[model samples]
Target: MSTKTPFKAIIIGGGPVGLTFAQCFSAAGLDFTLLERRETVTPEEGAGIAISPTTFRIYDQLGLLDAINKIATPIPQKHVMTKDGHRYNSYEFHLRECHGRPMAFVHRHELLTMLHSTLSDDAKSKIQTNKSIASIVSTDHGVEVTCDDGSVISGSIVIGADGVHSKTRRLMNDLSGHEEPVFETTFQGMFGNFPRAANVEEGSQMEPGHDWEVHSDKISSQCFVGRERGWFIIYRPLAPGPTRERKTYTEEDVQAFAKDLIEMDLHLTDKVKFADVFKVVNKAGMTQLQEGAVLKRSFQRIVLAGDACNKITPNVGLGYNNGVVDVVYLTNALKKLVEDAGQTEIRTETIEELFARYQEDRRALSETVDSAARRVIRTVTHSDFVKYVLDRWVNPVLGLDKVYGTKVMGPLLAKQQVLEWLGEKNYLPGKIPWVHRGLVAGEVKA
Candidate 1:
């Protein structure tokens, strides 16, 4: 297959998004070499990440669901509370019944490790770490990537999964003579993990809203109790400014930030304050949460995926999930193109058409996700009076949350994309039938 098609991919970055693309390319029988700037693919960082049923279906098709389930804790329950430790609402997710798979929460590092470990040996052999991309030049025949160490690698297309501060994105802009910023950072985030707090039940997620007594309008918090540990993320709005440049944080910065939040209650009971969790935190980091989709997802033969192209607030947990969706959409399209090309080399114009559709499909969904996540973060933080009323009163009083779960989100989940070439096994079919059904092997093409 590799020899048949002139479509080898040069994938940049080694995070969850890049790694997922690698696996998808391997499954599609497409050739790709992944170059990660980090020394190791699975860096032991970050608190937790959620895998939704939308993404679970893809993992199942890729033969990764079982391994993921072994390490991930399925979220069964959720609670919404006020800063004074008052639980306002509680409910079960019912994800499995509705979508066939539950929302699985796992430590970020563990998820990365699982993805890296499960890749085929042939696929694994193509991954190269400690390779930082210096520049990208696209020719009529292919794209060439030059590393900082003077190494050059060429491929039919270059994919940028290098994340929010994407070097590939920057270089692409440089080539096109565009200087506008790709994303905006409106909020700064802090995430950490600690030993499970006592009385915090496993499989439960807690969202404790603003502290009206102290900096109430300034922050929003979320915590999940996994089987072995607890993970938490706090989001605070940054002052309006030119915040496109990435900021680095130090230990002192974290300590100073934690000091302000130390007295905040977890809303489980009066006993569990932010201090209790902070004192035992095994790993923690601070980051600026960039939001927006890039204006251009592709230039010539170079394309962008994952956080490099679109970024959303983590409060909705759609950031990584959408990235996986990007993989499915992209791999399916590229696979079909390669197979259809037969003995002919794929032209740059044909690749442009593929990327145009890819960007259109992805941009639509990403825009919706970005809007929802932005609204959620704003509402949870009580950023405005209307949102405050919506979050504190209307949502709970009118049971809008449940309505959103069953009506709005349900249909979206049902329409979640899949690998078309791989076809469907319906491994996790539920009450809700998928809109885009895949054709099984040896089945008639629709």
Candidate 2:
């Protein structure tokens, strides 16, 4: 009689990180199931994502950049100005000469579509929508995950790729006899894109060389121009309140606010102003960000990835990129653990040791980034005293605009990814060689 290969992994959430995990799992010869709650994945509000050099290299290895590059734009320079329309400075931001990869901007839907398109037919078939997972139980044999339909599935381990509010994370903690403190909604963000103006030609000055960032005593606003549309964001740190709820905005409400934002003299083109762009972008959102992480990420049979593990303020655009890195590291870890079984039974103690190490490696990086994001937002949007220092001392004496955009902070944005450390090579030469730190699968760094 022939024995069956045990179902190895159950992936909760089929967003970018989940799908990427699914694909990586497949490549490692692991059999897994991917569950998504949406009927079909679609863009919630279309906005561009900054493809930092390191992130671009990873996508290139994943067979995604070719497709993404077709629709994405390379941002070369960023222009900084005050709300009063005084030009502060402009710098070569993409730093392609230094990093070997330009800062590329692709809409959220476009990248997700590319990720989905590149998935193998076998991998695509593993994705099941409308199948909501309710709870997870780790058995002596394997993990048993029950769906809202009362249906059950068996797997050796569960990976949570769910978003910031992850059901899988909660269930994993509950099942493993751990309790996590509730996270606070410290800040909120509003962002969306407006259609390109009629005069905004391909490779126009506005398209490639200009990203407008304006600062005032009270607030800061960020905007970037593209061939097709413009992306903008305004971060508002919430004051302490009894109830933690995000401010809601309607399309009409946000559009009206856009007019007020540019009530001063801010113009993309002579003809097309900030006021004009808002009329075109129909989809917009305002959401309270849960900008921190729990102390632990895993408990034996279950582990977390993406926003579920580290939800940061989107001000730095590190939210998804860091999550993607999380997927890569988690994937590498699981591949080794799955291989280690070697036809023997997987023990709870074995998985616990593996997961504990993984948590140690990832949680610190997540927390550091989350705290850094909060600090950046504070410097830009806090009281007039800080703004005075930024405008007078920081921008003029120290050249803060150039400092923040290029010199010191650039390397952190372009650090090497997991695949590179795994020895999966990319064609683009990295600027600063990132030491492997000996972080291969199933090995603890001394």
Candidate 3:
């Protein structure tokens, strides 16, 4: 008779990061279970996600590149302008030329569906929805996670891939006796999507699927017109007061906010105002942009990943991609730990050491991305005179855009994390070379 292995990983939340944990754990030949609070897996937000080469390269390794490529649209150029309708610059960064892949945008729901469908049947069977976590206890031998439904799950570790308002983070805090806030809200935003407008044509100046960014003294807006859908976001800086605290918005608040944005000029096409976009909106949301990085992401056998730990402003589009990198690193570390321990139960002390190393390796990079995102949002919104001058003159006049895109952005993308158990494949080739190649021939990086 064969004895069953005592190592099992429990993943909390079923969003992109959670699903990714499921997939990666499966690929690493690890036993895991995923619990989602929602009844269904599909997200109702219906927003668009920008998939940079930094992310798609990992997707390629996971065998998800072709499916995402089919549904996603390429964003080749970005047009920036002032609120007064003065077109400052249109930089065709040639993202494909720089990184062998152009930035791609896709609806979040479609991406989630594809991610869920691609999982193996055994992996799919392990995902349980409507299972909200009520409590988590880390024992010497393993972890015991109790759900609101009175169900109990025993796992070697708990990975929290939940969102910014993560319950797992709260539970970990309670367990550790710390209650300090993890993120700060700097900007509030309203975003929505609609079917493609009639005026947007394929080859015209108002080309369908064109990316445009308009900036003002205290606010900035982004518009992306796709072949089938159009997305818009207006970000406004909040005053430094107690009211800036994050809170849920009601439908009434959202509608009133929409009214305030109606007269705003978009500079997308001839005399286009936000009202035109609002009239046909299929879905919209008002959100507070929280920005920060947690210094400690894991407590004993419970580890936090993705938005649950690091919250970045969305202007830079690095939040999810960075979270994916966290998953990759954590997955690689856990895979090694499990393999090394063989069929024996992983000790809490050993897990703590592994978690410490994982946090050390990831914290600096996470902070860098966090700082970059904060700066980008501030510069675009002209939060200060220095930021205004940098965005309005210095960057354009000095051609720092190209420098940032190549010199700075290229290296960052090149240094992204990958699954170490899976050997690295040279699918993405450009001028920059990767610093950390995935494990090859069972040879580990020293």
Give lDDT tens digits, candidate 3, residues 45-105: 8578778887787787788888888878887878788875677877765567877887878
- TM match of model 3 to true structure: 0.92
Could you list the CA RMSD of all candidates, in the order they appear? 3.7, 4.4, 2.8
Using lDDT, rank the candidates from best to worst.
3, 1, 2
Give TM-scores for every candidate, taking all chains together and pairing residue i with residue i: 0.92, 0.85, 0.92
Report, for every candidate in turn, its global Cα lDDT versus the true structure: 0.80, 0.68, 0.80
Which of candidates 1 and 3 reaches a greater TM-score? 3
The alpha-carbon root-mean-square deviation between model 1 and the true structure, to one decimal in Å, is 3.7
Model 3 gets an lDDT of 0.80
Error of 2 at 267 (Å): 6.5
Cα lDDT tens digits, model 1, 154-173, are: 89999999998899999988
Query: Number of clashes in every candidate structure?
Result: 0, 0, 1
Can you tell me which runs of candidate 3 are displaced by over 4 Å?
Answer: 1-5, 200-209, 240-244, 268-271, 423-426, 438-446
Q: Clashing pairs in model 1?
A: none
Worst 10 residues of 1 by lDDT: 206-215
